[model samples]
Target: MGIKIVPRHGKSLKDKLYLPAIAGGMKTTFTHFVKNLKDTSNLKTMSYPEVQPEDLSERYRGVHRLTKWDDGSEKCVACYMCATACPANCIFIDAEERFDGVAEKRPKQFKIDLLECVYCGYCVEACPCDAIRMDTGIFSFTGSSREEFVVDKEYLMSNERSKDLNDG
Candidate 1:
């Protein structure tokens, strides 16, 4: 079927419809482009670490981070709340004992395969003890191999912003 549209404004019928629309679209695009150009000079973009850092509220859940106590120890009770609530089921946790607290069923080896992570942030919400969080703001990962995408405990906890993957 052929598309039909009514003319809005112009001297000619064609000009009234097509020309005005084209002009209007061009004007909007030009306005946006100019705004972006000006913003580039100012720290308009979120550079994360270099420029502006993320102001994550309690609501923001980027990726699961095990919480720390005032004494600088893990807060994860390993209740598996996050794992159970995780829609993606990317969280793989193995709990162990710290002998510090009754809830101290800490993950002996906690892992999250980024390959399967949908970034839904559900895991963070499900954490009752606030043990797991996704607010490190270290939101960058890249790899050349399948195994590299699977984020091990070392990579997740090392506080490193991952870049290029290793070659096999």
Candidate 2:
């Protein structure tokens, strides 16, 4: 018994070169350019720094902040819910018993590596006590080193909601 092999056709010169795809992309670009030239009102581009967006959606998720009670104590009960729910595993916390009786436990150490965080708001959603929020409206952040980007408990607690992106 013998096995017969079937011959397959190779890609054409145009297919190999991707000329059709390139032409399609160029056509799209030209069409959009001409449409934009005819009607510039549809453009949503903004001049940043000099003129910021007047309104950011309420649902906009920006920087994370740990909320505090009226007496200035952290609202977090050290439940570890936020850390567990974070898909990026950016949150780190060490809990200690609270002898003061304000809460059963408090975070002895809490840190969030912004670089590792995806900013998906999972931590905020997981906090049962509403101890964390992403309402600072700080979309832009810069750090000199990796250590600088890891915000500690104090930094997260001190972070307040900004009136605008520039305010933060």
Candidate 3:
């Protein structure tokens, strides 16, 4: 096959100097600065932790949470689908057969390393039973040690309070 070469577009003297691009950038910056100065409340910046932003979208995925069944039991069937789909492999599951036989299996130990997680939402999509979701809206998390970031099954199951935050 022959190589097809595309012709390069020629630039004028003004275009080669890039003065117009610089002026356009300066104009945009000055306009925003003047607008923010005139009405500070219109500024997009927010003083976080104390005064959270009110412009979070509906589809904003935050922290992970384990869903519950009608009987208040965990909805996860311990199928390992979530761990398999996770690109970061942050999810850890230790499955055990259920005694009640309501489900074939249940996670004896489930943990997710927040530090290693990329927040890609693959686990949520891979779940067959609708047991996992990233809709808690608890994005702002702080910890002094790495151990704190490793969320266990109990933490994920009892994360209802996190969703109540208006800031998130």
Candidate 4:
């Protein structure tokens, strides 16, 4: 069998010229602009810095944080589960044997590259010891340098959970 030649239909002058499509888009934009001008509240945007969201959802995945036990001991077992589960491969852990009875293995160093992290909760879910969590409710983070965004163990451990978010 030979290749079949399909008949092609020529586009209409209206289709050839994208002016109508552009005009429709412009019209929609103008309508929304006029509506927003009349009612500023209708726009789905918050006046950031001046106003913050009242509350974030319970499952809102924000920055990552390493949890601690009641005695102020780290909860991480240094199993590398978080690192393994991280899709972005942002988590890096160096394990050290812990002589203290608190846990078998503790992280000598744990670093998470916030810039590389996709804000996915896989790391939190992968931790069997309930060590890591992304519930700090800190969606906005700033840094002058790339190193500032790569948080170390101390930084992750020091990050406190937002009071506005549910502790549980």
Candidate 5:
């Protein structure tokens, strides 16, 4: 196949100097600055703690949480599908056979290292049983130590936002 080359458009002396481009950018900046200065209410700035915007989209993926069934039992079957699909390999799971027969297998231990997790939502998408989801709507957290960021099964289950995951 022959290579096809596109021709460049003609440019005047002023365009070559880049003065018009710079003036255009400065004009846009000055327009916005003057508009914001004239009307404080028109600015998009937020007071953060006091004035939080409630317009978050429903599809916003925030934090990961484990789902529960109707009978109060965990929905996960410990299939390792999430762990296997994680690109960052941040998820860890230890499966054990359930004696109660409610579930064929259950996670004896489940942990996720937040520091290593990329928050790609692959784990939630790979879960076959809808056992895991990233709908907590929580994006910020603090920890005293590295180990504290590693969330365990109990922490994931009882997190403040976990209860609201199924509401919508």
Candidate 6:
């Protein structure tokens, strides 16, 4: 058998497969580019800061919250149920008996690392006394440091009060 010389008039089979793919990718990019070029549509993004998401209601589930009682006292007994149920191990609690005597235990140092929290709501479900919950609705959180991300009980408790004030 002898090799035959053919004229280079067209693209090869490899080019046929890859050219269409390149064309499709370019078409997609161009389509988006054109859409963005039209200021009437503004197909980029929201104005941000000026256009933030709305607040969640009392019933709405958001970031984890530790609620205090009507008498301006912490409701958490810190039974470790919430910590045990937390899939991400975000909830950290140190229980100590209260002087009030009625409430056996309160969280001495309750901290939840939002970075590690999966927001699965298991901690909320595991609370027997309804102390820990995801109802505060202050979901927007960002931190530059690990210390900032580790939200202690004070911040969470104050957040609940702020929400209460807003709702009222």
lDDT on C-alpha atoms for all candidate structures: 0.69, 0.90, 0.88, 0.89, 0.85, 0.80
Alpha carbon lDDT at 163, candidate 4: 82
Query: Compared with the true structure, what per-residue lDDT tens digits does model 4 show for residues 34-54?
Result: 988999876788788668776
Q: Which candidate number has the best TM-score?
A: 4
Put down candidate 2 lDDT per residue, 71-136, tens digits, no spaces: 999999999999999999999999999988888999999999999999999998889999999998
lDDT tens readout by residue for model 5, 20-97 = 889999999999999888989866777875664577767777778898877777888999999999999999999989
Give the Å shift of residue 87 in candidate 3: 0.5
Residues 71-97 of candidate 1: C-alpha lDDT, one tens digit per residue: 766667778887898788888888887
TM-scores, all candidates, are 0.55, 0.71, 0.70, 0.77, 0.66, 0.75
Worst 10 residues of 6 by lDDT: 159-168
* Runs with alpha carbons beyond 4 Å of true place in candidate 4: 1-10, 38-44, 166-168
Compare candidates 1 and 5 on TM-score and give the better one.
5
Q: If both were scored by TM-score, which would come out higher, candidate 1 or candidate 2?
A: 2
Structural RMSD, model 6: 7.9
TM accuracy, model 1: 0.55
lDDT of 3 by residue, 1-168 (tens): 899999765478888888988999999999988988999987666678877666777577788999998787899999999999999999999999898868999999999999999999999999999999988878777799999999999999988734445455
- Misplaced by over 4 Å in model 3 are 1-45, 161-168
Q: What tens digits encode model 6's per-residue C-alpha lDDT throughout 57-119? A: 556556776788888788888899999998999888998878997587788999999989888
Query: Which stretches of model 1 miss by more than 4 angstroms?
Result: 1-61, 160-168
Provide the lDDT at 112 for model 4.
Answer: 95
